[model samples]
Target: MTHPFPPLVEAYLADLDRALEGADPRERSETLAAVREHTREALALRGSDDDAVRHLLEELGPVDSIAAAAAAGTPAPTPASGPPLADTLLVVLSVVSLVLFIVPLFAVGTVVWAGTRLRAGAGDRSRQKTALVIGVVALVAFLAVLVSHYVATA
Candidate 1:
């Protein structure tokens, strides 16, 4: 008999499929089916609450890791390397220069460019946090400079 899944389950499956994009077709199908079956079993045993679903997914770990394990016999895809030092430096410099009389737009642009690189690069938790913090601090500092300039000019 077919079982019905919550909307979140469908979304999760789609995300999982996307994560397994470059994997072998056969292995991908098997992995998807296995995950679905596991989800169904979890739903059956524990009520269909959001918490239960989250717990199940967490226990299964990330889809990328799962795909890698399934394809253990084959060479794994190259993981994303950490963000470049140049990108980090650009973000820091932009943020620090917020106090300069230069156009704020340039500083904002640099922060955005650096942030995109940090987010897109490999899953380096430390680097991600550093980039995020730097971005926020830069923005705040820039805004402060703008306000101060406006007040001074008036």
Candidate 2:
């Protein structure tokens, strides 16, 4: 008798998945990926009746079942990698760069510029940090002296 569930494609995928359960790690990976691709293709040609799903299932077999089976047998796959460098560090430098003046603005500015470039090029965070520190300190020292001189006179 023709099976009642018109979602034959889904049934076939389930069976395929079951079969893959008994497969080796490498075999399971390839089989599951292939079945997933077939599933995509089947979805694209989707029909209103269950017949299309059945037909696709007949053509593809039980992929989800195969996947379930494979899952039962083996370990999970690896995930994707993440990016380096943090947003916080970048923000810190930006904030610090603004509160500077006094140390021959040009010289301090150049250090900040070169330090920023160095950090970007070499992936060395310390370079920019050091530059920022030097600029701020020199500027503060100069300002302190000027303030002292003015205060003593007045």
What is the lDDT, from 0 to 100, of the residue 122 in candidate 1?
A: 30
Alpha-carbon local distance difference test for all models? 0.65, 0.52
TM-score on alpha carbons, each prediction:
0.44, 0.31
Whose TM-score is greatest here?
A: 1
Q: lDDT per residue, candidate 2, 19-51, as tens digits?
A: 666677686877667665655544443432566
lDDT of 1: 0.65
Please report the candidate that would top lDDT against the real structure: 1
Model 2 Cα shift for residue 89 (angstroms): 63
